[model samples]
Target: MGSLDLEVTVYSRHSSNYHSYKGNIGTVNDNILNQKFNAKEPYTVIHTDIAQVKLSNGQWGYVSAVIDEANQEIIGTVVSS
Candidate 1:
């Protein structure tokens, strides 16, 4: 079986290392590099009461989080191999 890797990062127009994600949205056959930082999102495409599934690179990698919606801090995280 093949293995995959995953990561979370933050980025912004400024140096927001505290809470933002900075990465390249992959193009056709290209790669996507992302950076994660502290951020507050008033709007989201989806919201769940609990951690459902982690984000993945479409390979073997997956990232799930147990987050504190009040603070937006991740209480727990799991990365698949």
Candidate 2:
């Protein structure tokens, strides 16, 4: 099993200097092909992207996924309508 944590950061310029706030959105398991994803890995190592698709019911959908570079396998997936 692997871990893919999602975070959202807010930056406010109206403040005196600059204020930033970070919040945890959620986590995803990205263990694919028996490999764990880590930031310390080399470039082109682990990749993630969002794909938009048309639902069968004539609606728009967004699919987010994490891919493992070693085997080019999608480890985790999330879909939203």
Candidate 3:
């Protein structure tokens, strides 16, 4: 009879600094919703982000998107050059 052996390996990864913002001006309202999301409420958190993009005429522009955290859906979007 022959003996068989098997081994298993696992890998785990995590990041503590996943999101960040810099160069913010004074008097920034960091908690506009009164920490509503911490209460486990729906439609209480909204997130917005801006991205630099290229236009159709080869020009640089900006695009911003506002999303609802509860459903992860975009509520508003804007583009400008």
Candidate 4:
């Protein structure tokens, strides 16, 4: 690798200043699930989450999805720019 002048891509560590500026951004909800992820029926234990993604055009977007715990299936999804 060194002989061919090739180098591996490396990711830098997150800056402490970034975290300090972030502070507490969201509200903390109660732990109603109690670490029990399994559900006996559909809709009884559905989980939802949102994720930020970088698009090909150098823009950011968000993807929100809801999953059924019992069936382990994605029931709903929404994408926003």
Best by TM-score: 4
Candidate 1, 1-81: lDDT as tens digits: 135564343221322233334577665552332233333562222223432232345323446766654466656667665
lDDT, candidate 4, at 62: 89
Residue ranges of candidate 1 with Cα displaced over 4 Å: 1-59
How high a TM-score does candidate 1 get? 0.28
Q: For residues 1-77, could you state the per-residue lDDT of candidate 3 as single tens digits?
A: 13556432223222244354656756866766676554245567777999865556755588999887877778999
* lDDT value, residue 3 of candidate 1: 54
- Per-residue alpha-carbon lDDT of model 4 for 1-81, expressed as tens digits? 999998543343422333335678899899989989999899989989988666667565789999999999999999999
Of candidates 4 and 2, the better by TM-score: 4
Segments of candidate 3 deviating more than 4 angstroms = 1-24, 30-40
Q: What's the lDDT of the predicted structure labeled candidate 4? A: 0.80
Q: Estimate every model's Cα lDDT from 0 to 1.
A: 0.43, 0.63, 0.66, 0.80
- Two-way TM-score contest, 1 vs 3, winner: 3
What's the lDDT for residue 35 in model 4? 88
In model 3, the worst 10-residue window by lDDT is 7-16
Q: Which whole-number lDDT from 0 to 100 does residue 39 have in model 1? A: 39
Each prediction's number of clashing residue pairs: 16, 0, 0, 0
Which of 2 and 4 is ahead in lDDT?
4
